[model samples]
Target: VGDALKDRFDGASRVMSNSDHETSVQRNDAAPHRIPRKDRYRFQLRPHNPDHKSPGVKDLVYLEPSPGFCEKNPRLGIPGTHGRTCNDTSIGVDGCDLMCCGRGYRTENMLVVERCN
Candidate 1:
């Protein structure tokens, strides 16, 4: 979903109609500022198979990032805490897989699963 949203946004700007004001802007600065270059939407998933040893599902909470978080942290791949194989899979958190950050939980290389209350 995040990837799709990004594609749509990119496409819209590419075909934007040019008007007098639009064309008057400096060539380098002319751009739709709605979605900044430095932003990524956030989504999370919970593991269908729960791991008791890891953090209880009840204690876990998904901390949503601001509109531009992805852009700010684009360099960081899917959060390592979610699991070593997180990157191989899409952003789907299911079964034993827990996402630490929307991209990768804050902690590095640790998949933090909150206990489900």
Candidate 2:
């Protein structure tokens, strides 16, 4: 990120380079990512044109779309929460109001029997 931003400014290359310092890549076990090293970061392209009737939702990777994740990927064309099931009592991102994109949710009871100690 620093390298990319620095590249935008004129003569910034003289201020810093690989020879001048050691750069560290942080490891994120919780949210691993493989970011491109330079200006190579570009929007993943679909075909030049997409067929509307196709089942593809345009994300480079398929995820059960929610506003929290989908809205962030505008160019990727993820279908944000139009027909997802949500858990109203969830404290995390799967909460009804968030995951359902405020369209609200329906409930159907299920029997969950667990062994007790």
Candidate 3:
């Protein structure tokens, strides 16, 4: 039922005509049509059998042929975090351990001069 609905929605734009839209609008304006109770109950009782093996379904859901995220590929605009500063104490995404991708990190101290008016 889900796949059928998806196919119908996908093809609606190509198949729908101006006359069809006008008719639908007219019907809507006349009386807001409500689904029959029996039909609603039947829809609810319908079993969902997903098409796991279908190539179309697989291509729609899975991320295939994705770009390489880690390496510094200038052409792909992926300026990898080779020397990015990360917090050493926090056990989060910003932490040195995770940011460095288990490659480890180095620490250095520097002096800065600031002026305020």
Candidate 4:
């Protein structure tokens, strides 16, 4: 099964290379306002035993695409960083500027009580 899938992928790569070359040549004479057509391919799986009643690859297909995690979505269980800790001094993604999403942060100071014997 693995070998058959690998062979199919290799063949698809060759076809893609040829189509890419043809598209590049066509782009030279194509209008700036025109959009290029995208290439689409479909694959079907054929089991060794036809009598088997197992589900095919189509069973893994989803009806709708997933909603990404850019903002807070309670329905999707994505708790976007509203009160999450962030670094005010740093400039990375964990920094206050990016993490707060332009909403300014307030600084809070807390005293810790520890007992050590």
| Model 4: CA > 4 A from native | 1-70, 74-77
**Tens digit per residue, CA lDDT, model 3, 6-93:** 7755533211111232233334656876656654333111112243332332223322345665568999899877878898888988
Count clashes in each candidate, considering only residues at least 3 apart in sequence or on different chains. 23, 0, 0, 0
Q: Which sections of candidate 1 miss by over 4 Å?
A: 14-117
Candidate 3, residue 3: Cα displacement in angstroms equals 28
Among these predictions, the greatest lDDT belongs to 4
Best TM-score among the predictions, by candidate number: 3
Q: How high a TM-score does candidate 4 get? A: 0.36
Which 10-residue window of candidate 2 scores lowest in summed lDDT? 12-21
- Estimate candidate 1's alpha-carbon lDDT, on a 0 to 1 scale: 0.38
Question: What lDDT is reached at residue 3 by model 3?
Answer: 92
Pairing residues by index, what is the TM-score of model 1?
A: 0.13
List RMSD in Å for every model shown: 19.9, 19.0, 13.6, 18.1
Q: What's the C-alpha lDDT at position 59 in model 4?
A: 31
